[model samples]
Target: MKNKIIAEKSGVIDVVIIGAGAAGLSAALFLVRARRSTIIFDAGSKRISSSKNIHELLGFENKSPEEFHNLGEKEIVKYGGDIRKEKVLKIEAISNNLFAVQSTNSFVTAKTVVIATGLIDVIPEIPGLKEGWGKDIHVCPCFTGYELHNKKVVVFGLQDRIGQLSKFLTAWTNNVTVVTNQPFAPTWIKKLSAVDVQVINSEVASVIRSNGKLKGVITSDGQKISCDAIFVSTSMQASSNLASTLCKVDEFGFAETDAVGQTSRPGLWVIGNANDPIGHLAHAIASGTKVGPMVTDYLLEYSLADLIK
Candidate 1:
C-alpha cells in the first residue's frame, strides 16, 4: 500500500487512538481482537524512526521502526481495526462519557479515547550536531550501541546521569568520552575513570564536522578533538497538548492517569509516553496492552447495564 491519506470522515469509531506508535498499535490490536470498533489516528511522529535498530524488545531485536510499525499495522488491520493517517489537532469532552477529536481533515466522536502521543527530544544547540543526528550522533544507546561497536564515541550530558550513561556506552565501545559543560565532573565520574572513558569538562561551543560527517567537538576555549560520533543525553518534553487540553496533567506535564490508565475525565484515557516517565518502547506497549482491555471491558459493561435498566 502507498499509505493513503484520506480526508473522508467515517462515523464515530468505538475507540479513537490518537497516535500510531507502538503503544497505540498494541492497544488497537488487542481491542480489535475483542471485536470492538477501533480507529487509530496517527500523527506520524514516532521518535524511533531515526533509530537504526530497536533493542531489548522481546522477540524483536535489530528491527527498524518502519518494520515494527508495518508489522504492527498489518496485525491490527487483520483483526479489523481501522488506521487513519491523520494528525489530531484538538480533543475535547462533549459530554460526561463522550469525546470529540478534531483533525485537519475530519472530526471523530468516540465513547472512549486513548492519548498515546509520545515526547519530543529537545536536542542541544550545537552546530553540525543537528546534521549528524540520527546518523552518527545518537540519543538512545539501547537502540544504537551495537552499531557503535569499536568506534570513538563521545557522550554529552546535560544532567547528572552522564556518569551512568557513560558506563552504559562503554559496553559498546572502548574509546568513550563523557563531556560535561563544567569545570569538573562529579566524584562518581572520577571513580569510573578506570573504565577508560575520559571525562571532558568543557563548555561545548559547536560540533566540528567535515565532508558532511561528524568529526569532533569544539569547546568554548577554541580547542577541538577528533571523534567518530556523539550521543546526547537531555530531558524531553511530552507531546501532550491534546491531552492537557482535555484533562488535567501531572506536575511533570504528563497526562495523569489511574492504575488502569483512566484519566481524570471519565471517558478519556492516556497511555505510552503521554503518561510514562521513562518513555521506552517496551514500557509504552505494555501500558497499551493493559489499558486496552480495561477500557473495552468498561465500555461493554456500561452498555450492558444501560440496556438492562
Candidate 2:
C-alpha cells in the first residue's frame, strides 16, 4: 500500500482534509487537537444548503445550515485548523507516496486525506424548483414534516419510485396524493390505492411558489392541485469526484469504507454522506469524530516508519 517518495516534498503539510461541513470540521478539530497540521478545503456547496433549518440536532433544533457550518469553522480555526474555500478537483497518489490534492486553483500535498465531501441531490426539471426546494417542496419528511399535518400533500416523483413518502405521510395526515410525471407500475398504483392513497398520472409543467414557498404543482394540462407541501423524490449522489478515481466507489458513486472510515485505498478515509448516502447529520459527525484519532494514529505511524528509513 506504500509508494516510494520519488518526488520532493516541496511545500506539503501534515494532512489535507477535503470538506468543511459538520463531518469534515469535526474531524479537523480532533486532528488539530492531536497536534496535526490539518487543512480543510471546502467547495461551499452541499445538500443541506437548501434546508432552512436542520432538525434533530441537540441544543439547536432550528439551526440554519450556514450557521451550523460557520460555528464549526470558527471552532476549527480557534484550534489552528487551516481552511480554504476552494473546490478540490483531483486527488492523485504521487511519487514519494504522498497525495497531491488539486483544487480549482491550487494544489497541496499531505500524508493522509479525509474525504468528507458529502452528497448532492439530483433535482428533476420543474419551473420554480430552485426557489421552492427545501421549503414547501422537500424530500425527507423526517426533516420537515411537522408543518403538513392534516393538509393536502402532493407526492411528486419518478415513475419507477414513489418511496416511503406515501406511507410516511399518513403518520402526519391521511390526506396524501402521489403524482408521477409518467405512468407508474400498476402494482404500485394498486398498493397505494389499497391504503386510500390517491395516485395521479400527470406530468408537472411548473411548481407554484409564492414568496419562495411552495404552493403546489401545475400540471401540463393546466390543472393544478392545491397542496400545503410537495414531497418530491430526489436521487442522492455522493460527492466523491476528487477521490473516486483514487478509491473504490459503489455503483451509486458512494465510496466503500470499513468500520473505521478507511476506504479501499490506504491512507485515504471517507465519512458522512460521501460514504453513506442515507446517513444523517449525527451519523456524519460521529463518523468524523471516530476517524479523527484513527487518522492521527496513521500519520504518527507513517512518520515513525519514515524515521527508521
Candidate 3:
C-alpha cells in the first residue's frame, strides 16, 4: 500500500520512527491514533523476513512476516501515520528537544526519534549453512521447536552458548546433539549426558544437504552426522550505526536503554532488536507499544512548555 504522507504545516514531525518493522509500526499506530504527526522510515530489512512464517506469536503463528508487516503498515496509514520507504542516513540532535533526521533523498525534523532498526545475526562461516537458513537451519528453537519435535537436531557455534543451547533444545527433542571442539567441563558433560544429549567434540566443517533438504552437517574430522535440522549460535551485530551514534551502546553497538527503551539521549529512544538483540516478535511489538506513550508525553511536554512561554 502506498503511504499517504500527512503533510505537517510546521514541517516538524512529532515522532520520527526509523524502522517499519513490527515495533516501529506498532508505535506509529499508537502515536498516529493520538493525533501525533508520525513518520516511519522503513528500509524493509526485518530480521525475520527470511523466515517462511512466524512462530511463538499468538494469533500470528504460521503467518508470513511480510503479511504481518503489511497489515501493520496499513493500520498505521489508516491512522494517518506517514510511512516513508526511504532509509534514514543520519540523525542529529539539533536542539534539546528536536532532531534532524536525514534520509537518502530528503531530511525531516522531529520532536522525538525512535530507533527501531533491528540487529543482524552473524552466522558462522560454514558451507551450505546459508542455503538452508530459515528453513532447516535455525538459531533458536524457541520459535520452531514444536515443528522439530522428536527430530534429530544438531547444535553448534559459540562455545559459551552451545552447551546451554543443546540442553535447551532438549525441551522439544530428545534426539539432540552438540558438535563442537570446545571442551566442556566434566560437570557440563555430565549434565548434557543426564539429558541424553550427545556431544561430539569436533567443529562443523560444512553443512550437507540434498535436493534442497537438509541432510546433516559434515564435521571437521570428515565424518558426516545425519540430522533433521541444525541450530547454531550467532554473534549479534547492530544493523545500523544510528544507535551507537545517538546513545550509549555496547561494544556490539546494541543501544543500552532503560526498561522502556529510553536511551541516554533524552529525545531519542531505541526499541526492538536495536536494544534487545534476543527479543522475539512479541517483545518487539511490546517494546514499540511501550514507547509510544513516552514519545507522546515528550512531545506533549514540549507543547505545554511552549504554551506557557
Tens digit per residue, CA lDDT, model 3, 1-309? 344555468888888999998788888888888888888898867899889999999999999998999999888888778788999999988865689999987799888999999988898788899888798999999999999999999999888998889999999999999998879988889999999999898999999888888999899899889999999898998899987767789999998899999999988999998888889989999999999999989887888988998
Write down the TM-score of every candidate. Answer: 0.89, 0.88, 0.96
Ranked by lDDT, the better of candidates 1 and 3 is: 3
The TM-score that candidate 1 achieves is 0.89
Give the runs in model 2 whose Cα sits over 4 Å from its true position. 1-11, 159-161, 181-191, 210-213, 307-309
- Which candidate model has the greater lDDT, 2 or 3? 3
Question: Residue 88's C-alpha lDDT in candidate 3?
Answer: 92
CA deviation > 4 Å runs, candidate 3 = 1-8
| Model 2: lDDT of residue 232 | 77
Report the C-alpha lDDT of model 2 over 146-172, residue by residue, as the tens digit.
777788888877544574578777778
Give the Å error, residue 253, model 2: 2.7
By TM-score, is 2 or 3 better? 3
Shift of residue 191 alpha carbon in model 2, Å: 5.4
Better of 1 and 2 by lDDT: 2
Worst 10 residues of 3 by lDDT: 1-10
